[model samples]
Target chain A: MTNSQRTPYDGIVMAAPVTIPYVRYSIESAQWWIGRALGALVAQAGIKASDIDGLCVSSFTMGTDSGIGLTQHFGLCVRWLDTIPLGGASAIAGLRKAARAVQARDADIVACVAGDTNHVDSFRLTLENFSRFNQDAVYPYGAGGANASFALIARNYMRTFGVSREDVGRIAVAQRANALRNPHALMKTPLTLEQYLAARPISDPIHLFDCVMPCAGAEAFLVMREETAASLGLPAARLLSTIERHNAFADDPMQVRGGWAMDVGELYAMAAVNPDDLDIVQTYDDYPVITMMQFEDLGFCRKGEGAEFVRAHDLTIDGDFPHNTSGGQLSVGQAGAAGAYLGLVEGLRQVLGAAGPTQVRNARLGLASGFGMINYDRGLASGAAIFAGPSR
Target chain B: MLQRCEACGAFAYPAREACPSCLSPDLAFADAPRGGVLLAETTARVPSDVYFRERVPWRIGLVKMDCGPTIVAHLHTDCVEGAPVRMSLQLDKSGQAVTFARPEGETPNMADDRQWREMTADPKFRRVLVTNGRSVIGQEAVVALKAAGAKTVFVGVAEPWRPFAGEDLLRRQEGVEVVTLDAADEKSAADLAADIGGKVEILVNTTEYVRAGGLLDRKGTSIARDEIDQAYLGFINLAQAFGPAMRMRGADGINNSVAWVNILSVYALANWPAFGAYSASQAACLSLSHCLRAELRPGGIKVMNLFTGPVDTEWFQTVPPPKVAPRAVAQAIVSGLKNGLEEMYVGDVAEEIRQRLAANPKALERELDR
Candidate 1:
C-alpha cells in the first residue's frame, strides 16, 4: 500500500477480548488465538465474513502466513487485503492499512485483530522466529527475546538521548500507578523509583519493572464506517487522517528521521490538522525510550526533548496532553493484542467522555501512535492516528 | 535468638544480611518464640508458575512468629498454631531451604467449633459465594433471601480470593449465604455488580485482602500471573453465577449493609508490588465494590469493599504471619454488617493501603521492563 491521497475514515470500532485458549501450546499458538479472537469480533459485529473488504492485524508472536490465516480462519473474502507483521506496532500498522483501503475505496470496512497467549515459550520462539531474519545481527549476542533486544535498545537510548536511570524508574513507577485503577490490568501493585532502581537490572538502564511481562491474554477490535458504528449503539471516534513510514534497513539512529517527523506536512495537510490540535495522545510505549523518541517524532515536542516531555508528567491524564489513558501495556500487563488495542479504546473513551477516572476533560482531538519491529537498536515501523471526539 | 533491629525496628530473619529494610550492617540475634498464633493464609488449588508448578496444591501464607518479624512459608496439612506447632527450616534435596511445621497438640477449639464443622461438612459448600456487599449476610438475611428461594447463592467478596481464609468465614457463619463476584474479566465484573437487583436479598461486603509489607519489600517478580488468574477465577466466577439467583429471589427481607474493612499499612497508598498483587487487585476489587454499592443500591443491593490489614489464621506459620486470627477477622467482618458499619478496619496495615488509595498517587513510572 502506497501513501498517496489517503482520505480520513468517518469512524472506527475495536472488537477485542476475544479469548483464545493458548496456555498449553507454543508461541505460534498465539497467532491462532489472534485469528480466533479477531474472527469472533468481526462475526459479532454482524458484518458478514465476506463483507470484510480490508484486513489488518498486528501480532508480535505470529509469522508471515499469520495475517493470511486470519482471513482463512474467518473465511473473509477480500481482494484488497494487507498483511502487517510488526509486533507492538502491528495494531497501528493494521489501522494504517485499513485507512489506506478506505482512501482507495477498495474496501469500505477494515478489520483489525491482535491476541496471543504464547508467551511461556517466548524465549525459544524469539530464537527460532525472530532470529531468522536478523541472525547476523542478533545470533552473535545470544539475544533471548524482545527483552534482550530491548535491553540493548534501552542501553543505547539512555546513552544517546540522555535519559536518566531515575527517568526509567519513573516510567515503570507511573505505569503501576495508572494500572491500579484498571481492573483488567494484570499488574496492580505500586512501585517507587527507589525500589525500581534497586531492582536487579536485566540490562543497562533497564530494570525488571522497565520491561513488560510476557503475559497470556487476548483482545481485538473493528474499524468501520461512522454510520455503521452509530447503528450498533457503539460510539464513534472519527479518524481525521493517518500517516505510515518505515525505515526497516537503517543502521543509524532514526530518532530524528522516523515516522513522527518524516515529512508529516502531507499528513497534516491531508488531515487538515496540526500537532497542537490534539488533546490526548497514545504513543507506542514498548520501552520508555521508544515512548520518548516517538513523542518527539510525532512532534509533541522537539527532538532530544522526549525525556523533558515525559519527566514533566506531560503524558498523564492530568497533564496538558494525556497519553495511554487506559494504563497502557506497561500498566495493563502487556496482553499483546489487548495492549495494542488499548490506544483505540482510550481514544474512543476520551472521545465519548467515558474514560471514567482517567478521562481527559473536554477532550476532542487525540493522536495514537505505535512503534514496533525492534531488531537490536530501534523500531522499524511507526504508525499514527488522528482522532476527533464526538463533540466535534 | 531473634531480636528486632534496635535501629530500624525491623525484625531480622536468620540474623542479618544487612537488614532487608534499612540495610544497616549492625545487627544482633535475639530470642524469638518457636511458634505463635496463625495469621492470614491460603490453600492452593494447583501448584503454579514455572519455578513451582511441580508442587501443586500446597499451602503458602504469612505467619507472624512468636517473635516480631512476619514471614512467609509453606505449611504441612496438620500445621495449626495457637495450637502447638514445631518449626524447622530445612534445606530440601532441591538444595533450597524452606520452613515447615508439625502440629504439637490438639487443634485449637476455635478451629473445631460448631460453625466450622457445619460449613465444612456441607457438600454444596464447595461453591461458596462471598458477597462484598448486601448480596447476602448473616442467618436472618440468608433465611430471608432463601424464603424468596433462588437456586444459587452468589457470595460477594470485597477482596481477591483467599480460599482458606474464606473457608474460615463460612465456618463461623452457619447457613451464612453470600455470592462471590465473577469479575476476573472486565465485562463480567461489571455484569456481576449490575445483575444484583431482585435475585439477591442480603448483601455483605467482605472486601479486604491481607498484606504484610509496604512499597519497598513488595516483590513483583515473585508474584506470577498464573497465581492471580487462579485467585481471581476461584473467587469471581462464583460471584457471577450467584447474581442471577439473587435477581430471581429479588427483595425478600434481606438486609443491605456494605462493609469496607480496613487493615493497616502505610504505603497502601504508595506503589508497592512487594506487598503483592493481592493489595492492588484488592484495591481494584474494592473500587468495584464501592461502585457496586452505589450502583446496585437502587436495585436493593448494597456494595462495599472492605479494607483490612492482616488477620491471624493457620495461614501464619513459624515463618511469621499477621498477628490476628481467622475467628477474630471473621467476627469483625460479620459484626461490621450486623452493626450497620460501611467500612471496617480489621488491622492497622489494612488501613494503610486504603489511606494510600485515598491520597494522591506518587510519581511512579509506568514502565516495568525496558
Candidate 2:
C-alpha cells in the first residue's frame, strides 16, 4: 500500500480499558487474570463477549496456549488474531496490529488484553528461561536476574552522562507521589529521595527503588472504529501514531539508548506533533534509568543528556511534564507482560478523561512508550504510540 | 580463537561454522586480539546458578575486543571499567571456552591459564610411581591411577616379606611394576629413583606412620621418630634423588614429570592430642611440600598436597565410623593430581577442620584441646 492509501489511525479509537490491581504473589494462573481482564473489558464497554470479532493477547506465563486456544476458551470467533509476545512492548505491538486489521476491514472490533500471574517462583523461572541467549550468556554469571543487567546499564549510563543516583531518585520519588493518587497502584506509600538513596543495593548502582516489584495482574483495552466507539456511547482515545523497533543498535558495545531512538522521529512526524505537544507522557518505568534513556532517545533531549532532562523536569501529575500519571511500574508493580500495556491503558484513560485521581487537566495529547525483552545485555524490543482526545 | 569470513572480512566469535554477516562457509580460525576495552562490569553478589553459588561475588564484565567481537568474560578484580584489558580464552571447569580479562601489566591468574589447565588434566598415559605401594592407600592409588590411563605404574614396596592382600593381583596386572625399596633407607630411595626417574611423569608419596598417641605417651619419642622418618625424611630423600632427573627431563622436553602428590593427615593443620606425633610429622611434610613447590616452579612441576581425615585402613582400624574409605582418598588424590591443586581437603571432617582453622586458629586449637 502507498503511504497515502495506508490508513491513518486518527479515527481508530481505543476504549474501555479494564485494569486489575497488581498482587505481589498469587497461585492463580494466567488464564484466570486474562479471563477477568477480557470480562471486565466487555462489561465496561456494555457489550456482549461475542460482539468482539478480533482478539490480541499478551502474556509471558500463558503456558501452551496462544490466541487460538484463548479463542476456543473464551468462545469468541474472529478473522484477526495476534499473540504479541513482545514482553513489556506487547501493548503497543498489539495495538498497532489490531488497528491495522480494523483499518483493513479484517475485523471490526478487537479486544487487546495483556495479563500474567506472578507466583513465588514465577519471576525466577521467567528470568531463568527468558530467552536462549539470556539463559546461556547472562544467567550463568549470577542470578542477579533483571536487576543485574539493568544495574550494569545504569552504571554505564551514569558513567557516560554524569547521572547521579539522586537524578533517578527524583523520578522514583515523583512516581511514588503519583501512585498515592492512583487506586490501582500497589505501592501507594510516599517515597523520598533520602529513602530512595538509602535503600539497599540489589545490584550496585541499582538500588531497591530502581527495580520494579514483579506482581500478578492484567490490563485490557478495546480497539475499534471511532464511529463504532461513538455509537456505543463510550469516550474514544484516537491512536495517532505508533512505532516499534528491535535490535536497533547492534553495534553499540553497551546499550546507552534503545530502539526508540531509531524510530522516534518518524513517530512524531507521522503524528504531526512534537514532544512539546504532549500533555502527558507515560514511559515504561521498570527502571528510572530506562525512563531517562527514553526521554533522550524519544527526542525530549540530546543523546547522553537524559540526566539533565530528568533533573530539569518535575514528572508528577501536577508538574509541568505530567509523566507516568498512573505511577508507572516503579510504584505500580509490574505484572509480567501486562507491564507493556500499563502505560498505554493509563494514557488512554487520561486522554478519554476517565483517569480518576491522577488525571491531568485538559490533557488533549499524550505519549506512551514501552521497552522489553532484555534477551542478553540489552533490551531488544521498544515501541511508542501517541494518542489524542476527541477534539483532535 | 575467532573466525574470520574470507568472503566479507567480517569476524565471528566462538568459532562459528559460517559467517554471520555474509553467510559464507569460507571461514578461517585465527588468534583473537589481545587488546580489549572493558565496556561494563558487575560483581554477582548473588549468583544465579548452583555452579557459581559457592564462588559468589564473582566479577564479570563485557569486553569489546579490538578484533570486533564483544565477549562476556570473568574480569580480573583489578580491571576497572572503561579501561583497556588483556583478554584471552580459557576452558572453564565445565570445559567451555570462557573468555577471561585482566588488567594490563598484571599476569593472568593461574586459574584462567590454558597451559595451567592442560598441565592439571588427568595423568592419562603417563608413567606413575606410588611410594609405600604395599599399604592400603598405595594399593587403592595403584588401582585408581591405572584406571586413569597411566601407561605404567610402579609400586614401591618397602617390605616384600610381608605379603599384602592385593600384591599378587597387582603383580599379575599388565604394565604394573613392583619395586622393592624402603622410603626410610636413603640408598633404596636413590636406587629406585634412578631406575624409573626419566619415565615417571607422576610421583605420589603416601608413606606415613600412624602412631596414634598424645605427647605424654610412654612410647611417644620412638613413635614420633618413626613417623618423622617415614613421612618427612622419606619425602625429602626421594625428592632430592628424583627431582634432578625430573628437571633434566623437563629441560630436554622428553615427557617430564608434571606433578608430585603428597597424601597427609588433616591433623597437620590443627593437631589432635590423640595423634599429636603423627600430626607434627605431617605438618613438617606440609612445610617441605611448600618449599618443594617453590623450588620446582622453574621446572613446571606441580606439588599437590591432600589433607585428609582418618581413613578405614589397618593403621586407623580403631578410628570411629566417620572415617573415609581408602578408595575415596585414592580418588581424591587422582583428582587433585589431575586438577593440579596446590592443596585439597578430603572427607567432611577434613574440610570442616580446614575451615575452622582458617576462620580462627586459636579457636580451633581450643576446640581440639577440649
lDDT tens readout by residue for model 2, A118-192:
988888889889887676666755567788788788888888888899988899899999999998899978998
* Model 1 chain B lowest lDDT segment of ten: B115-124
What are the candidates' individual DockQ scores? 0.01, 0.29
TM-score of each: 0.47, 0.68
TM-score for chain B considered on its own, for each of the candidates = 0.38, 0.70
Please give the lDDT score at residue B168 for candidate 1: 53
Model 1: per-residue lDDT, tens digit, A1-392?
12447444545433322333223334456656766675676666665666677776666665456566766766777666665667666766677666566655677667666666555566455544563334433322223345445554555456666878786566556666666665666666877778888876554445567666556556555666666666765555677777777764342422333665774665566567777887887767666666766767777678777778777765566766577776677766565654566666567667767667777889988777777665433566777777776787
Best by lDDT: 2
Candidate 1, B1-370: lDDT as tens digits: 4546767866665344576567877677655566754443344332123222333333433355665554444455566533545544532212233444445565554223321221111112212233443222232223333333323445554343555333454445544444445334545555665655433334333333343343456566444343344344423443454444543332232221212222222222343454445545554454454554444343333232344444443223332454544444555544443333445555655555455455634423121111
Report the CA-based lDDT of candidate 2 relative to the real structure: 0.84
Residue A261 lDDT in candidate 1 = 73
* Stretches of model 1 off by over 4 angstroms after superposition: A1-28, A39-53, A60-65, A75-80, A230-233, A248-257, A337-339, A354-357, B1-370
